[model samples]
Target: MVNIDGHTILTGVLAHPIRHSKSPLMHNNSFAKLHLNYVYLAFDALKNQFSDAVRAIRALDMRGINVSMPYKQAIMPYMDHLDETAKLAHAVNTVVNDHGVLTGYTTDGIGFVNSLLNRGIGIKGKNVIIVGAGGAATPISMQTAEEQPKQLLIFNRKNGHSFRNAERNAKLINKSHPGLAKVFDLNDRAKLKAALHDCDIFCDATSVGFGKLKDQSVVTDPSWFHPDMVVYDTVYAPLETCLMDVAKKAHVKHVYNGLGMLLEQGAASFKLWTGKRMPVDYIRKLLLKSK
Candidate 1:
């Protein structure tokens, strides 16, 4: 157990390859602001040691952990119970340790929803288009569908496999919320453009704006975005991604980065771990200052 200022505080790490995760900065900063004696770090775990690292989390008396990238799904089996949302998404991003039993949860979905709702962009009765079909997309799509959106559409770049995986995930989401999810092939620009034309919100769930792919953007056409549409990108590093830039230039009503979701989800995980509700405004201000 780690002790800080006589407090036996616990810790967690966002594990992934090339993980310069801002989680440590965001979470540790919050802990400091709240005068809590705790720390959060980042770990670049080797593939073979993933299980070992998770086991160590318990042995070390860690309060909880946040999983990222390749290990989100890989760490599922080690969890004692999965929250309903995590089980549906089949991915666990946050884990809580309750007396050695680690219960898994996915705050990404609800995080994005809370972010949008907090921004006054109502998900209810709005049509949403989510770009990308990877792990990140799963929770976003699943949680968004629960909001009873008028329609939830998913688009992936790769033709066959990507679209298929998205469809399978959509089907799983639809199982809980019937007739609310749809998958589309983005390879066909015409269909993609048509779908965008009818969307009220566009979410970039891909890794198009991070690290080496910072120069890349998923949406190539500006004409597809309208002035009334809201564009939200799940990339926060640059604060403004290429997709967000185009959306702004096009006079989109509300354009936001994933920073809000990041904060809200961290808040959720914090609540799970400590059974205390975090101050949303405090966390938001901290993130803005860091930006």
Candidate 2:
């Protein structure tokens, strides 16, 4: 059981439909392992009530909270400061309240980078392709671009705002590293096939491979994968996603689920709240066993 007292510091994640979050369990277990006087919880809050939720962080003197979905971009206006990555992505996922001042940071990028690092992989000097431009894909794309990859390719449905987001991201990256980033339509199978054949790292940040769309995959053909590429799917549920399975069937050298990204991002937030590194390996094993 979690030890609660007046001195226990409060931390949590704020999002609508939050009952499915694994954050509370992950952080609470980590806290218990370290014997830290911190308690983590999940709060289900709609958009209108978000301002009040931010105020509660100050009123309760809580350490911080993780913002999700609709709140990631919506929660930014209330922050006193935003870390560079948060500003770059134009979204916030982690907020740290120092005294009464709340600062926002986007750790999803760090999580993605560190997850690759954990497996002895780095994006530098490698051709990289990211298949999405939403919340998960945007930061990953921005961060991967920052890592000086040989080239970065972003794919998204051409008809939606996500396609605009892809164009915006490619433009932003091109500003710093001219001609290093490009955008393409996800429906252009010929281009996607060429990118997969040439790219060294392929990441699926889309929602197609999990939840109600668990059976679907952005890359419908398993033959598109090659042995030299590293494949990563940012969906932890049903751990082995269709994309990962497809990569495996093609004999891709590295296949990973999003569990590491989840752990690493939470670890980054944990460090922001408390100035210590999270025991990532232990937490990884714990989560896997529970799964």
What C-alpha lDDT do the candidate models reach, one value each?
0.81, 0.89
Q: How close is candidate 2 to the true structure, as a TM-score?
A: 0.93
When superposed on Cα atoms, how far off is each prediction in RMSD? 2.4, 1.8
Against the hidden reference, what TM-scores do the models get? 0.92, 0.93
165, model 2: CA deviation in Å?
1.7
lDDT of 2 by residue, 1-291 (tens): 468998999999998757767788789988988889999999999878888988999999999999876578788899999998888887789999998999999988889999999899999999999988877788899999989999999989898667988999899889999999999998889999988989899999887787778998888788999999999998887788999888989989999988889899999999999888888888888888875
Error of 1 at 281 (Å): 1.1
Residue range with the least summed lDDT across 10 consecutive positions in model 1: 1-10
What is candidate 1's lDDT per residue for 137-161, written digit by digit as tens? 7898888887888989888866555
- lDDT of residue 23 for candidate 2: 81
lDDT of 1 at 41: 74
lDDT of 1: 0.81
Clashing pairs in 1: none
Candidate 2 colliding pairs: none
In candidate 1, position 225 carries an lDDT of 88
Shift of residue 269 alpha carbon in model 1, Å: 0.3
